[model samples]
Target: MSEFIEWGALGQVVVAGLIIGAGIPALFALGLRLLAGTTTQPQRAASGTRRAADGGVPAGPVAIARPTPARLVGAIACMGVVVGAIAFGLVFLVSGGH
Candidate 1:
């Protein structure tokens, strides 16, 4: 009886893993489609600034610069801290910790 129950549990886990593995690509494709549908095409930057007939300076900066490495790292660190806090809360709840 115990052996039969273990086999059933193992079969359930195998079936669930197979389903999840099969679903991952479908889910990824669906997410891509949704993202593509919702996103607006970005406007192209002007190749060269148009100058006044009198030779005036260009109005704005040429290109937007990328964030510095420190800023990017700080932002990622903040996100990790938030996710870690949420995970700790979930673990505490599941473990019945006060």
Candidate 2:
């Protein structure tokens, strides 16, 4: 078995495969989580208000907070890694695995 397989090269291929396959999706998810800010819920109207006529529930638009500078940077970095990996794979394929 050892004679049939170059263990070192196979190990490297497995390691690279695992990293690219798992790391890219994980980074993308992290970027999305970082970029997704908190949503502001609609406030309830005071008593006897026009909105109160509709069971005190005011129909208002939910506002999404903008990501902080640090979060934005983090998201960019994470997504950049994912994109870079994809581009590298594409280039590798186009280059005929050269």
Summed backbone clashes in each candidate are 0, 0
Q: What lDDT is reached at residue 93 by model 1?
A: 90
lDDT of 2 by residue, 34-93 (tens): 999989876655554446566756766668999999999999999999999899999999
lDDT of each: 0.56, 0.87
Per lDDT, the best of the predicted structures is: 2
List runs of model 1 lying over 4 Å from the truth.
1-64
Among these predicted structures, which one has the highest TM-score? 2
The TM-scores of all predictions, comma-separated, are 0.35, 0.73
Model 1, range 1-98, lDDT digits (tens) per residue?
A: 68547888789889967755655445545443333322333344365554576255444544444555665555555555555656886898999996
